[model samples]
Structure formats: structure tokens, C-alpha cells
Target chain A: MLSPAYLAVAAALLLALGPALPAFAGRPIIAGKPAPSEAAATARWLTAQNTWGFLSTISSDLSGAPFGNVVSYSDGVPGESHGIPYFYLTTLDPTARDALEDQRTSFTLSEFPLGTCGKIDPENPTCAKLTLTGKLKLVDLQSSEADLAKSALFTKHPEMKDWPKNHHFQILKLEIENIFLIDWFGGPKPISPTEYLEYGKNQALLKLS
Target chain B: MLSPAYLAVAAALLLALGPALPAFAGRPIIAGKPAPSEAAATARWLTAQNTWGFLSTISSDLSGAPFGNVVSYSDGVPGESHGIPYFYLTTLDPTARDALEDQRTSFTLSEFPLGTCGKIDPENPTCAKLTLTGKLKLVDLQSSEADLAKSALFTKHPEMKDWPKNHHFQILKLEIENIFLIDWFGGPKPISPTEYLEYGKNQALLKLS
Candidate 1:
């Protein structure tokens, strides 16, 4: 292993040249961001890496207008992602209440936060962005899925496990019906829910890695 | 002013102790993030500082379900923010098309990307998140407002000026009607559109600064 002094020097060099480099510190891409062409893998990877996304729902209070809210979520615990995003929320929040009144929802994530986009503008087509549209349904608290979801969520957002009991936080997951991803210039890549969900299983056998 | 060597050392020290620091490089808060109690200022600051946010609108193709898309927006040319977000969108994208069919939309921004949230969970109310619900109206290319918007957008997003002409990108502005800002624990701050828009003008004399 390299000495601590050497590691510090290397890290200092990275900081000095961070802006000039394509990828740098605390960025998800350094671990491994899939190529833009791998639509399903890229989409899955985004879900797995991002701890939070913007959740949108049809507003009941605003007379059916769409409302977008920043929310924390987990696809799975660390590396064992299953593609479906689980959220811990309370009805005191409009997003959760809106979902109860209207299940239709969409969750959006961006690669910009991951710091992999380099100098590219967040709006640039080359900077990956994903939107998953579906029904936001509450998982039965007593079910096995809820147990798995809680573990997935707590691992990514540790504070979530200790959220105030008075708020009555519940587990909700996006039953993804459609996926909209833009990682390249062509346009939004068409990724079916099944294709995205199955990417991890096929990755071991396929050359996507 | 510090010498180059001293500045490099400072930056290296920051990187070395980054995890322990509440705020670091490239974060918007380093300049000025308003106190959480100043709801209107906090909301406007978020709109002005953030280059992009999640835009949600009623989907035309999805039978009225909500759809959220990652978009880049400019509230103004750098520090001259007018408190209204302007977006350069193409009809080819679903967000623009959806807005055409239904103007009701909400744009969400989070402090997480600004790096000011530090170790706070994004879902925590202290991290500061804003949702602006409004009507997404296409600004007529012939209007003088469109010219100002173009200047504002191009100033921040230089790439937008060079976007493909064939795409027929248009300027869209959000006519914010409701503002939901969660800057600290309690619940969403009650700030009307007028209160938010008026904050900058009143900040000159108010102690909020």
C-alpha cells in the first residue's frame, strides 16, 4: 500500500488539477460509471449511485397540477441494487400526500451531482439524466419487501432509520412503468422497465461490464 | 493576497480535511446562503444559485400522469436575478411538449447539489429544498422579454447559444404562483409568489442581509 504522505500528495495533485480533469474526488464515476451507450446499465447505475432524486406527483391540493419535491431514495443497499427505487416519506409532506390522492408520479436523477459530467453543462445531452414514471405505492409495512426496503434505505441514508416516530415515515416504491434517459445526443433513450430491472442479472453473463 | 504556494497549501489542507468541513470548494453557500428563517430570501437564493432543477408537468402521452425531467434554467444573468426561472426547451422533448398541452408545472431544487448541505440528509428539512408551482408559458420569440431571457440564459449557459437551430429551441418562463420552501424543520415555509419576488428589492434596507 502507498504511504499516507504519498496518498496525501496524490490527493493534493488531484485537487490542484481537479477542474482540468474529466473526473475527480467524491464523484461516482471514479468508482465506475457505465458508458453512455449502455442505456439499461447506465440507468440502473444512476439509480444505484444516487441517494436522492426529485419526486413529482399530481397535486391534490393544487387542483391536479404537477408538484415536484426533493426526496431521498434507495434502489438497494450499496452494490446489491435491484433497479426499483424505494422512498421513506411521511404524509406530512405534500409528495407523500399527493401520491395517496394520485398515485401517478415520476422521479428524476441527474449525473451532474455525481461530478462525472466534467465541464459539460447540466442541460447538455451528453450529461446523463434519467426520469422514471410510474405509480408510487406504499409497501405493506409488515411485508418482506418493506423489510428489504428499510434495510436498503437505512444503509444509504442512516439518519432515516431514526426519523421521528411521530412523523410516521412509511416506505414507498416506484412501480416503474416507463424510463426516460438522456446520456447521449440522439435523444431520450427508450428503456422499458423490464430491461432496466433485468440489467443487473444479465450483466454477469453479458459483456456490459 | 496570498501567494500561489500558500493558496495551494490552503486548498490542499481543505481537501485533506474536507470530510470534517461544513462547507468546501465549488459550493454556492461559500458566497452567501441566506439564513433559514428568511424564507423568501432562501427561496430566491436557491432559484438564483442553482443552474438546473427538476421540472414536472402533466404528461400528454402518459394520460395525465405527472412527468419530471431534469432541466437547466437561469433565473437571471448571474447576480441580476429577477426571481423568475427561464428555460431553453425544444418541442422534441417531452417536458416542453407536456407544457404546451398543460401549463401547470412545478420546478424543484435542492441544496444537496450546491454542496452546502454538508452531512445533512437531503430529506432533512434543514438542508433547504424549494418547489415552485407555476404555469409554464412559452415566451414569444418576438417579445422583448425573450431577448432579455436569452441574454440571461446565454450568460450562464454559453452552450445554449450554440444549441442546434434545427431543434427550434424556445424560451419558456415559469409564472410562479405558489412557493413551497423548506429551509428548516417545522414544515414548508409559507411564502407567496409576491413575497418571494419582493425579497431582493427589500433586502437593501432590511436586516435580512
Candidate 2:
């Protein structure tokens, strides 16, 4: 084993090499992830950790084809996740336009980008993926829930605050009805929407304390 | 200006650091991405570089809700791309099953994960995102095109070959109808599927020479 003096020198070297480290080294403050075995917790962790995912809606433009668009979202502010993803979208984009015409949608996230699945193929079941299917509903700007959503979104995606005001960006959220989580080799984990949303309420409280 | 000797020393230092360098520094051989100004080229680049994306289909299980699932795909082997995304999907997954019932689908990809969009919020228009909407069609196993797809899929996603044979994985290709690409601040760049598929044909031929 190395002596204390040697360890101290190595630590100093690492500190001096700041900004040269890999980007993944400085992960954003994630609202803790759950063990793979905890289906509800795992599903919630995906919602909290991922900053962007594909949001799908039945497209009126494409004669009712399912259109998936890359979108940024937040479940809550860091370490205080509520397991419901909120998006800032504009009808100028097809996804929002489609949602207005057809509320049915799904938001899909993968753990591959989280940098935890080293050397594993992203398609591999062990890497984990989540699909939350539900209605994509607009949040009324005047509602208290919209206030919470705005705070959650702005904190995670600071750039959203400065998007062109004329674009009429509105807050939209998925009223999750079904949760499909694949965290292991077997089939999808059975996670009801309610179980997923409530999985870490106490833990989040503990973290805040 | 630094002396030649000084520059050589700096280069040596970087080489010695090896794994300490940022992971993006070691990007896989990408079919060179076109300038952001080349809308069709940029859209094709997104498809050629990304290994996985969100495939959205009309979900039969969820009462025709648009379902987005994370899936692995390939447009071609490294340095050679045809701009058609091929997926090895199993009906055991909802996405494939959904596609069988309703072929209308869209595959979405983002450049943020490719590590090219440094410090850009994923939702930012400059970061680049693509959505290919089309019919997801199965390639018959007996067709010569299936052989080409298999080669492309195996080269990029080797683990696919090892997946359980009993899982009934089949090759599926998106017959792209529309292309939505956002690479700059303006808006989605309008690109026809034909323009996207043919954008780099001449460049690809020149490279082969």
C-alpha cells in the first residue's frame, strides 16, 4: 500500500489537472439512482438523471404517424425528483403541434449516456432503458404545478429561460400511465406509474435534510 | 510563437497522458460530417454516427398511443453509409410489435451524445437533432439487401449476433418519408428523404477512389 505522503502528492497532481479530466467525471448532481433490482426506483432514476429524451406524439402532419422528437426535460430540480418529466415546447415544433392534436405520447430514455454502462452495448438489457407512456398534457401557466415545473425545467436546462419569447413556449408533462423498464436480462420490470412516481419521496426528503 | 522543440514536447506530453485525455478525443472513424450549412449532409451524418436512437411507433398494446423505445441501429458500416437506418428488432419488444401493427414510425437522434456539441444544452438548436419519419418495414431474410443490412448491423453492433436465436430478431429498415433536422438557430431544415440519402454519394465514391 502507498504511504500517506505519496497519496497526498497524487491527490495534488489530480487537483492541478482540473479541466483536463473527462467530462463524465464531473457528472451533474443526480438525484441518486436506485439499485437495478428496484424496478420503481430504477424507472424514477432514469427520469431524474436524463436531461433529454425522445418524446413521441401521434403526428397530424404525417397523417397520424408517430413522430419522435429530441427534447430536453426535467423531472424536478436536482436531488428532489418527483418522477414526472416536464418539457418546455412550442407549437412551432411538430412535437408540440402533434401533442395539441393528439395527447397520446411516450417519453423514452436510455442509461447508455449516463456513462455507467462501460463496454456494454447500449441495446444490452443490463444497460437499462425506460419508456413512460401516457398523455402529453399542457400545464396551464397560471397553475401552481406549472410554477413547480418551470422551476424544475429552468434549473436543469438554464437555456430554456432565454428561448425566444415569441415562440410561445409552454410547459407540457406526461401523465404517465405505464412504465416499461428494462434494467436486467429478463423481460421489462413491472412498474406501475404510481409506484414509480412515489418510489423515492422519502429518500428525496432525506437528501434535502 | 512556440519553438518547434516546445511543440514537440507538448505533443509528447499529450501522448504520455493517454487515457487521461477526454473520451471524445478518441471518436470512432465517422464518415466526415458535413458543415452545419449542409442540411441534408448534417442529417445523414447524425444517422451515420449514432448507434442507437428512439424509434417511435403507434403502440397497439397502449391503445394506439405513440410509443418511443430506445433501440440500436445502423445506417452502414464505418466510413460507408447509405442513409437508411436498419434495426435488429424482436417482436418480444413493444416497438417491433407496434411496427408490425402500424408501420408509421419516426427515429430520432441527437448529436449531443456524440460529444461534438461541447457544452451545448441538448435542446439547443445548434446542438443538432434529427427525426426521420417513415414506415418501418421488415427486410425479408432471403433478400440480398438483408445480407447488406446484416453486415452493417454486425459491424456496428457486434453483440446483436450473439443475442438469443430464439428471440426471433429480424432486420427492419425505415422507408424514410420526411427529414427534420435542427443544426442551427433558424428552425428545422427541410430535407427530402431522397436528398438526404444522396447527399454524400459523390464524396463517398471519391473516397473509395
In model 1, what lDDT does residue B27 have? Answer: 20
Count clashing residue pairs per candidate. Answer: 0, 0
Over 4 Å off in model 1, which ranges? A1-31, A202-209, B1-31, B202-209
lDDT of 1 at B63: 90
TM-score of candidate 1 to 2 decimals: 0.83
Superposition TM-score, candidate 2 onto the true structure: 0.82
- Candidate 2 lDDT over A1-209, as tens digits, reads 44445534654564466545321121221234555556776777677778999899888888988888889999888878888899999888889999888888899999999887666678777678999999899999999999999999999888677676777899999999988899765589898887887776666433321
lDDT of 1: 0.82
Per-residue accuracy of model 2 over B1-209 as CA lDDT, tens digit each = 44445534654564466655421121222234455567886787788888999999988888888888888898888878888999999898888999988899999999989988766678877678999999999999999999999999999988677676777899999999998898765588889888988887777622321
lDDT string for model 1 (B1-209, tens) is 33445544655665466544323221222236775556887898888878999999999988999999989998877768888999999998899999999899999999889887888789887688999999999999999999999998999888777676777899999999999998765699899999988877844522221
Q: What is the TM-score of each candidate against the true structure?
A: 0.83, 0.82
Best by DockQ: 1
**Docking level for model 2:** acceptable
- Please report how far candidate 1 places residue B100 from its true position, in Å: 0.9
